[model samples]
Target: MAITPPSNRLWWKEPIHGIELGWIVIAFLWGLFMFFFMIAWHFIGEQNLSTETYKVKPERYQERVEAFAAEFQAQDADGQPLEENGVPVVRPPVGGDAYILARLWEFWPILELKKGESYRIHLSSADWQHGFSLQPTNINISVHPGYEHVVTLTPTGTGDFGIVCNEFCGVGHHTMTGRIRVVE
Candidate 1:
């Protein structure tokens, strides 16, 4: 039913209900509580994203990614280089920097990481913005063009972790998935 104005002119003069007044006070208190809680969590939360970013040209970043991938490229059993969809599969050394480039529909250079070892993963986009979501660990960060983002992470579990794009980029957004293998 549509709301109608009070039929009586004396409606404004009526006393407020006690229950309504109590709810109003409770809501105000709850809002204040939540505001403080968020501030406290920022200081205590362990799942914070890294703020280390650098300005770099897209072409230069791509060149670095290619060189990193080639330096640590894994070989196949038949003596040829291993590649997935034309992108090399690399196994970076422990405590070293690794590079991953996000482009139109894929993330280049599948990474093989050793559990319990730390690695600095450099993430950047070649063309547009992309989302870097690491599964099981639930780490998510934004990948943008012309800026490199560095995240230092240590894998605690050994398994195949997926890197999925949470941002919608284009018609093939659903196909924008990458792989990371963590081994003991």
Candidate 2:
């Protein structure tokens, strides 16, 4: 069709069709409803992102994680060291603090926890930002250097939960993975 303007000079002031106006109003109301729903969900939703964070030196955080791991290092059934990918397996006491330090290509000190018990999990990064993604349960969060993010978690099931770094950090990002083993 040839490009042309409405013959009437006052076409810009013409009233919109009733059907078109109704659709516009419906879309506007839907957007408003969704915007308010997100705010309300923060108060009533079961799965909510935690906002508890503290500023800390990455070096200091690393030291704390190392000490925590050393205190609760686990041993194998045959009296050998229990490890995952060369990282010691630590079993923190129930209702205690569990530290996870993320670095270039690994999360140090594999964690072992008891099912149905809560833990204050502290996560931080040593060098750069990383993603704390707990598989199966799908608790994903960002871990940044010099910031300790605390999240209270109680494992509802027992198994080996994989922690994958969803945020790419470096060339070895693909090899960055950790483990959390929960027992009954």
Candidate 3:
């Protein structure tokens, strides 16, 4: 008599049952739905501030910053050139662009904005990496010496917002503070 080998496949390895197959299909479809939903919300449904940014030599970027400061000098309530929190201030006109310099331990030129106006704020580091954190609203932007980081913001509330460097640069890192005032 000839001996035949048993089947190589286990019984459980047979084609999946209809109920199990249906569950797998449903799960796969749900995953696809979630993926597409996230894409739509990020690209369309949110107030994303993806500003137009580009790379430049640090020296070149600094030149632009100096020119911007000379152009939009800010003044205090007394009609004198303003100095907010001990740093120079720049209150650009409505619908205009603004610049802030993040160096070793200071953010040069505090920003003053209209409560309901929008601005294109460009930031760059003159020395090392820094973090631009605006309090109350809790907005953060990365500042690098050779790259320009741009962001758009419209202050809905009138108040003074604090700017802190979240990156550790040196001994005075803890005191690297700046401010922006939103007025009516």
Candidate 4:
């Protein structure tokens, strides 16, 4: 029997050639493209994260929420108490901060913003974790207790958008549907 040289090496260690080499270069280029694409998408994208964020105590948050409710009790030319399903609707001033409180089976003080105007939305949970999903526009934010999730958005259209809780908080999760109205 003829003795052969030892050739115990991993497949990857073997010299790549022809189509394999082309694939390797293609994969490297694809990775580089994705790296820069994600950076721009996160930083310069419309769905970018808001840089301003802060912690909020639940009690003080509730107090602010109550005050906000009372402040907007008077309605505009459209309607008074601008509400649906008995949830108080808030039509915040143009280019201002809006707050949405998330608790069990409810997003209290439904929001109403103006079209072509920007809004800084402050979201927080009263009890457990919740997901703030704005449908049609497809914006989802995490609502955490004792912490606030802030997002800045401009309403491009005038319509009523739906808010659904995606996080499984308890048995009442299915009932946690809120509404946001955007007016022209």
Could you estimate the TM-score for every candidate? 0.91, 0.91, 0.73, 0.79
Model 4 residue 106 lDDT score: 96
- Which stretches of candidate 1 lie above 4 Å from their native place? 1-5, 9-15
Ten-residue stretch with the least lDDT total in model 4: 1-10
Q: Model 2, residue 1: displacement in angstroms?
A: 11
| Residues 35-85, model 2: lDDT tens digits | 999999989987886789999999999999999998899988897878866
Best by lDDT: 2
Model 4 steric clash pairs? none
Q: What residue runs in model 4 are displaced by over 4 Å at the alpha carbon?
A: 1-17, 74-83
Candidate 3 Cα misplacement greater than 4 A, ranges? 1-41, 76-79
Q: Model 3, range 87-155, lDDT digits (tens) per residue?
A: 678878888788888988998878889998999888889899999999977688788888888788889
lDDT (tens digit, per residue) of candidate 4 on 44-109:
776666766679998888778778877875475876566667778777777787888999989988
lDDT for residue 129 in candidate 2, whole number 0-100: 93
Runs of candidate 2 with Cα error greater than 4 angstroms are 1-13
Candidate 4: Cα lDDT at 59: 80
- What root-mean-square deviation over C-alphas does model 4 reach? 4.9
Pairwise TM-score winner, candidates 1 and 3? 1
Tens digit per residue, CA lDDT, model 1, 1-184: 3288677667778888999889999999999999998989888987677889999999999999999998999888897988888878899989999999999899898999999999999999999999999886778988999999999999988989999999899999999999998999
How well does candidate 3 match the true structure in TM-score terms? 0.73
- Give the Å shift of residue 86 in candidate 2: 0.9
